[model samples]
Structure formats: structure tokens, C-alpha cells
Target: MKGLYLALAALLVAVNCEAKEPPTQVVYRFDDHRSLELKGWDCDGELWYTDTQKGIHSQVWSQFYRIFTKKFIHPSERYMAISSWGGGFTVSKDYGKTWSGAHYSPGENEPNGDNRPPYDDILSFTVVGDQGFLQTKHRLYMSSKPFDDPRILPGGPGIHYELEDGVKGDIQSGSAGWAWGLIYMTRQGLKGTIQELQTSWKDLPDKTPEVKGYTGWDHMRCDMDLGK
Candidate 1:
């Protein structure tokens, strides 16, 4: 009888230990030089972009603009999209070591003084479900297979093209499958919006209404905690 009790207690302790272990987390770290550098861990907990020479090609590192990752169509398949400072975009089926460029051309609509490829200088890009979305100053584009072709998403005029009063905008995606549209301070106030991409964007209600009295705002690098 004592032996049976001891075995039951050991089993309970083993279950408790397993329950106390934390789940794996995906982390993204960004650094900026002339362009931007991004490194992260995938769901497997393997560190990506660690190799200096073989991690990312030289051209990609120098002109890197932004990098986005998502579990698009398949929950098991992770996809990464990277854009350039000048104009083009690329995709990595694996975590970002290798890439296949997108065949997009802005042509006559290309921004002035941006000498890189026409498809490179993306203002914001993200993947929601099976669809990938890209926003330039002028248009919003969507694609399923991003490397093949991307078409313009309707309702471009409804979207805010640029930040008001010289403010900057950063678009980030949440693991819950929503995009957070964060705008820096403007003449009016600091604004934030949430977009599901099913409909147009909407303003997120101000949480701290009591806090006020800022004249102007400049860009600042701050860490964002994306909670599961």
C-alpha cells in the first residue's frame, strides 16, 4: 500500500512539472543602420539570421527596409516577407536566409529619387491568413502567391496615405491576426487604429484621456510587448 501511494505521488509530481514548463515564444529583434536589420526565432525555437555571411545576402542587408512573418494559409507553414529601402520585395519560405524576389513594377508611378527597384520601397507590408498586403504611398496591394503577382486592393482613397502634420506611421501585425496601425504624435494628438483587413481601419479609443499637453513629437525606438 505504501509503494502504491508513492508511485501515485511521483506521477502527480511529473504532471505538475510538465504543466509548469513555459511554452515556446517567437521573438523578433530589430536594429537600424543606414537601412534596417531584423532577427527572430521561429516556432521551433531555432534562432534565425544568426550567420553574418550566409544568414542574409550582402545586398539584402544593405537595402533592407522591413521584415514581416506570419503563419498564413497553413498553420504549420511560416512565411517571411522582406522589403527594400528603395522599392522591391522578397519572400523566404524558410526563415529569411534565402529569398525569391517579387515581380512587381511601379513603373511611371515610382517615387522620385528612389533609385532602387520599382517594387522595393514599400511603406508597409503584412500577411493576414492566406493574403499578403502591401502599402505604398499611393496604393494598397494584395496577393496570395506574392512572388507571382499582386493586385491593387480596392478602396485606396479611403486609406490614410501619409501621416498628418509630419508624423510617422508604423504598421505591426499581432499574433491574433490583426494589424495595429500606430501613428506618431500629430498636431491633434497621438493616434492609434486597429484593422482586421475585412473592412476599413477604425480608431482605437484613447485609454489615457487624463494625460495631455504635448506640443510635438519625434520618432523614438521603443520595445513593444506582443502578448499571447
Candidate 2:
């Protein structure tokens, strides 16, 4: 009986030690000059500001394990936006006090439009004022009002895709603005361009001007001010 009690005590000690292990930490920098470091442990999650002296804060959502990127229109903590690794988008207007639903489905058919599924390869999600943009593997979808009534941006599918061979590149959004934009790589070179809200696309002449010897590129990133 003495030996059995000792073994049980040792097992309990091991379990306690395992429980005390630190959570996985990941830092995400956004174009709105916000840097959030997330500490995730199972179903519990915490976020801390890396740029300021603000302390850690908890999140009610449990599925923060694999957030790809986040964006917001202003520097304030309100109206935070994030995209998940499993191709979902979410928004919090009150510093995460409450959250909008995580949108995963493309919903039903549109009036006079073909029935297409919601994008399942969301690489990035961003919001600029009342406008929102979602970048997928092969297309860019935009909503003039919040996250509703999404429609394909004109010339968007071609931005990330090569015009010559129809091959898609690694495309992603960088900043949140009325003129927010995307960066992509092609056989020609790496390029950056912007699209105004409900307007046309324009190229940035100075950004990523050259990629001399590189055949391909991936995981492109910009600074806190969006390479400004």
C-alpha cells in the first residue's frame, strides 16, 4: 500500500508539471501599426501588445490556434479583424468584448449570378473604414459594407494570376485603407499594387522593383507602416 501511494503521488506530480508548461507564443504585425503577440494553450488564449506597454488580455474565442493574419482600419483596438488558417473570417468591434460570426460558407446563390461557393482559401482579411477585403488563393473578394454583400473585385483575379500562362502566385493584402492593396510574385518579378474602394487598380512603381535572380517567392511581408 505504501508503494502504491508513492507511485500515485509521482504520477500526480508529473501531471502537474505538464500542466504548468508554457503556451505557444506567436507574434503578428499588422499594417495599422499594431503588433499583437498571442499566447495559446489549448482552448485558452491571450493577446499582448508588442509595441506598447499594455498587459496581456484574454479572448473568449477558443479557436485561435492558427490565425494567419489580422488587419484594422485604425490604430485603436476597436474593430479588430482576423482570418483563420481554416479559411474563416471574424471581426470584433468592441476590443473583442463580442464578436461577429465567423464566416465560413459562401451562402446561397445570388440573384442573376452563378452559384459559387464561399472562398475556402482565405489568405488574408482586412477592413478599411466601411469596406472589407478578403484575399483567397485565386481571387479577391470585396464588400462595400462591412462583411456583407461580397462581390469579386474587377481585375482582381488577374492581379495574383499571371496573364501569360494563367498560373497563380502568392498574393496577399498588406495595409488597410480606402486605397489598400496587394503584393504578388510572378515570373517577371515581384510587384505591388493598390486598389481604391470601388475604384480601379493602380501599380506602385517603387515597391519591390526588382527580384533579380529569384525564380519564385512566398510569405511576403511589409513593415508596420506598410513599407512606408
Task: Give the alpha-carbon lDDT of every model.
Answer: 0.33, 0.39
The superposed Cα distance between candidate 1 and the true structure at residue 110, in angstroms, equals 8.0
Could you tell me which residue pairs clash in candidate 1?
86-121, 87-119, 87-120, 87-121, 88-119, 88-120
Tens-digit lDDT track for model 1 on 75-160?
11134444333434455455455656653422222346222223433444443332345544554444332221111133222323
User: Where in model 2 is the C-alpha error above 4 Å?
Assistant: 1-13, 21-26, 31-33, 42-60, 69-78, 95-97, 104-120, 146-228
Count residue pairs with overlapping backbones in model 1.
Answer: 6
Per-residue accuracy of model 2 over 42-137 as CA lDDT, tens digit each: 422444433233342545345444444333222325545554444444556555455554442232222334222244444544444433455445
Scored against the true structure, residue 54 in model 1 reaches a CA lDDT of 36
RMSD of each: 20.3, 14.1
Candidate 2 to native Cα RMSD, angstroms:
14.1
Model 2 lDDT vs. the true structure? 0.39
For candidate 2, the per-residue lDDT at 212 reads 36
Q: Which portions of model 1 miss their true places by more than 4 Å?
A: 1-77, 105-123, 145-228
Give the TM-score of each candidate.
0.29, 0.41
